[model samples]
Target: MAPPTRACKYGLDCIRNNPAHFAKFTHPAKLVATRAAASSLSTSKKLKNQKPILTSTPNTDAPPSLSASDDNRDFDAEVVAATHPTTASIVALVSTAVAPDVLANISGVTPIRVLADGDKIAISSYTIKRTHDHYYCTCPAWSINNRPVDARTCKHLKLVFGDAYEAARLLWKDPFGNAPPAPAIANKPKRKKQEDKASEDEDEENDANTKKASSTKAKKSKKNSDSSSSASSSEDDDEGTAATKYSAKNRAKREETKLKMPALLLAQKFEPTKTDPTGWWISEKLDGVRAFWDHERQEFVSRLGNLFTAPDWFKEAMPKNISLDGELFGGRGKFSETVSVVKTNNSPHWRKIEYQIFDSPSMASQPFEDRIAKLNALYPSKAASFLSSQSSLPSSSSSTATKNSHIKIVVHEKCKNLQHVLALLKTVESKGGEGLMLREPQSHYIGKRSNTLLKVKSFYDAEAIVIGHEKGKGKNSTVTGSLKCQMASGKEFKIGTGLSDALRIKPPKIGAIVTYRFQELTNDGVPRFPSFVCERIDANKPSDAVVCILKKD
Candidate 1:
């Protein structure tokens, strides 16, 4: 067969003969159309060597980069010249020309596919992933630049909705707009007119109102001062005899009441027996400060109220008309820090402390279940909602009454017997906790043990100074018996245990300081039956050896 003609004999030709036809192929719009038409063909051979032809076009203001390219310089200049005059206008034009569907398919992950019919195009919903503020398309043509465009516009985005990306740039306008225009000045001469008497009357009325308001405010201030003075006078009068009486009554009541302290009580590690079994309750010993909340004052009072300044938030959460015995906890393992915070005159951390109430003194007269029921009602929603709506309110209040509504009190489940309780105590101790509380379900709420509440803790040591000696009693009347010592915190107590017979015979010198091991704190600021730990030889004065009372103030 003869060599194929340059123009194929079959009429179908790879190269066009007319220069005009080839020039049309160079136009961006025409090139895109031709590419689309060629893409529909099944045979790749027919499209070989079909380079985009170019047409000459004058480039008066062509970009330097475009002129550098010889083959498509005219085409590039033409496209650049065709762009809208203003950058913003060009962006808007590009934004509108880009097809949404092409943008969707830019990334196969979440293609912004579009179906277009002339003027109308439907956009398919898709999510685009942005990396480093640039959009990447999985589409084949994206690799031409080896990265997404600096404008973050993708070819798929351009093909779908035509130039929407550019429009988005224009839409990102400064919220405040441009600086406001300078105010215009008036140059006209003033006109003379008779002044209205009503204006003067209005001014006088406004001045009178101002004077009246000032007078009213001053009078209210004076009234408040008078009321404050009267209240102070009354407080002063009550500070003497009445105050003492009140304090005595309160102390007596508190002493008579059974308060649960968070301190662990140490017990002898003895085996259990059928008749005399060791009793215990398993409870997560909350690492919180022991606080006695006095509902009457709407304030949380520590074991020693004078020591800490309770935050207003805590006071706000406190239930009115109900005294709660609970732990003022601030999460876990922050006991020393929590104590330090509560002891400060005014601490921001005090707000973090929460009262994990375990007992209610107001319910002392009721059964354990009933008291708990009342507590549950006062608790915020998450803790408990078991108690009846009426029982939830503070005692003696109407069922519809709302008071101290934000306080939350959680009641733990009761143990079956002493064995179960002891297991809980062990668990608490093993976890570096204070102890467990045992409440008799059937017993009434009382201040003292009264067979209602019991505390279990581990043995811990405290240092004290020898204060005095107690004369012997009964069979050993000849020798001094109890050695009275004061803790370094200024707490006085006797250490009658852990003393050798010889030490008992002739206790450490009167001025000598020593350490005492105690389990928990007693209500009267004394250690719960302390025992001698060791002698301290470095102390100066015996009184200085006493345990210093750690106060919040």
Candidate 2:
């Protein structure tokens, strides 16, 4: 008999169990019914094939096909084990009574339900299989993880079975020993509910007691069911989802490799009066979202180590062996558009974005001059002496270059004098450029902020805590009018400028830190004209350099 290819609309909820209904459309629970019925006949030739559930006798030489609501309740053991599959169920799977290889295996089973794979969530045509307590995904995201084999998981698994199951699937070393029942499953509540919490401690205590008391009884119930098989593991998922939530202590027992935090170089404020621009590398400071490419993981991560899910085509163009420090840019003054695209998972808008490479972390030991030389040699690039070659008329921005390439080396020019830098700064600012960046000659890239690298913006920028919100006046009254923020120095101010219509309507949360730009500081230590830049996702708290000063840059 052939397998059913078309899907039943009602699926698991369908009550029809007759042969006619089974042949017309497939149910995940009855996938093996057709094959099992055929095989069951060759073994016994006694039990009639009216019902497909019971294909074998209890005492048959063939593997016992699971029984159901016919008469006895004894055959529901596998269903019970699968529905609320806990740490105890995993132990019973590997116990001495069962075959050594018959533990936590679900590869032969069909998927819980059909899901189309591609883009924002699932992987197209990717295979996810589990065998004997270990999961394997053929997707690039899963393969690129540096974690151990048992701990590896992809978005596909998280999308289908969920994060709770993945967190609790770690193996038990003592399979033969009595195992405790797994704690009840529950995901963390929303932010508002979490902020107003009281009963969580009591719930955790009750779960701890439940696991301890039910351990031995749960362990004693495995009936040499390695040879005992089922049609589908997805059937009882509605009521059988066990260990969905585990206590903090229980989650601590799971295996994981800690993620390595990136060490990126920071910039300092350019003091034109003290710092000389006569013999340094000058480049147009791009107002783009910052990103660091980790070649080991084959992905882009923030400075704080949160992974960015880029499209497969976008990442394929990048080098798999070398690390890059740069920003995801969409030309000059396209900061909002670039951030919106980059924040989305597997966004199609990624094609519009270009990776602007400025420095290489791998070449940090080498001199800055030598690093630029390497970049020029490897890429079709614009040289650092670009300013003198062409006038500032043709927007030092990009062209139809992204059609053929995904990366571009930021062009740098040799600074002539203080007057020349000031003239170029005004020109760039007029053309909607952020400002200019000055790098000292022969300077090595270091992780911390140093005088070697400087940002020469006309306005001062800093971060502040989003402490409160004030309602808008007149037409804007329905949305947030202004945000009341506090500086690290304890000075508070209101910023109602530089906010987009979309942001003004929603606004950043109370505790979130946002970057703001100002002209200068007042005698009271407050910013004279504070304006919002954007909310910061990399850091929750502001650095001491908030409201950073620069004299006539």
Q: Report the C-alpha lDDT of model 2 over 1-553, residue by residue, as the tens digit.
A: 3445677776543333344455556565433332222223222233455333222222212233344332111112232223222323322322422223322222222222222211112234676654323455665444433333345555466544343444443222222222323322223110100000011111111000111100110111223333222112221121122212233443344213323557877778898789878989888776666678999989887665545556777777677768888777765555545554664443346777777778888899999989877765667544434333343222232323454376767778888999988988877766656678899999998976678988887877888898999999877889999999988888778888888899988899998999988755643567755788999999888642444332211
In candidate 1, which residue ranges exceed 4 Å CA deviation?
1-287, 303-307, 331-333, 380-410, 417-419, 460-505, 508-530, 533-553
lDDT of 1 at 198: 9
Q: How many clashes show up per model?
A: 59, 5
TM-score of each: 0.34, 0.42
Per-residue error for 425 in candidate 1, Å, reads 2.7
